[model samples]
Target: TLFVPEGIDDPEIEPGYVERAFATASRMTPFWTEKSRQAHDIQVRSGTFAVTMDGAPIFGPLPGVPGLFVNIGYDGHGVMCSIEGARRLADLMAGDAEHDPKDPFAAERFLDGSNPIPEPMTIHQVQ
Candidate 1:
């Protein structure tokens, strides 16, 4: 049940979103039975977020801001990588020696001219 309100920057959940959600679910999946929909209690949640230029995470220290580390722009995989990502960022902040030299998620890539080519936007790849 992915509800992506396109071009919406407002963090507040809009009115009638629950109805639209159920409708989209039903339309996209045959498994969303009437019984299931009727038995469900809908609760809406919303927030604002930013996406990186290349649709990948921007982790580690922010350039020109000493001691300010960031771990943002995970696209939609924050839940999947939160634990590992946090550990990596913490290690880097603590001056640990085990940090990867070629860290792919480094924030400097945006400024260092090493950013990967941006992918073509699609419905499933919205960022």
Candidate 2:
């Protein structure tokens, strides 16, 4: 997926984005063929991106709100981390695992002023 790094405040889709997307999709894609699909063809989808303050995904419960859990703040790793995140959250809910508040992905880390969670490598590729 291509990341543009912009807020949703402006709801308009730019023509440049469409062009770039079409260009990227047409490059060496096995499923795309001359008879099946055109290189310039593209469909616009509505969606938004979410990112936490420290650029790490948040997992576990919402502090001070018992029984109300959350598995959000994925930013862009939802596709990659969905299964594991779901499993971990489920384990916590089922009492099979424990939640470490100091962990980078912990949902309670945002509320802890004394402890700051470092940004995980998911935010950038190590070059």
Candidate topping lDDT: 2
The total number of steric clashes, by the backbone 3 Å criterion, in model 2 comes to 0
True lDDT of residue 52, candidate 1: 77
lDDT of 1 by residue, 1-127 (tens): 3586654665667788777666788788866658446756766667655677777787787778888888888667678866788888888888884444367787767776665766454133524
* Model 1 residue 6 lDDT score: 53
Q: What is the lDDT of residue 15 in candidate 1?
A: 89
Cα error of candidate 1 at position 15, Å: 7.0
Clashes of 1: 0
Quote model 2's TM-score: 0.66
For each candidate, the alpha-carbon lDDT, in order, equals 0.70, 0.71
Q: What tens digits encode model 2's per-residue C-alpha lDDT throughout 1-127?
A: 3466654554667668765554566576745344235544555655657777776677788788889888887768788987798899999999999888877778776675654544666543324
Q: By TM-score, who's the top model here?
A: 2
Give the distance in Å from residue 18's predicted Cα in candidate 1 to where it truly belongs: 4.0
Q: Give TM-scores for every candidate, taking all chains together and pairing residue i with residue i.
A: 0.63, 0.66
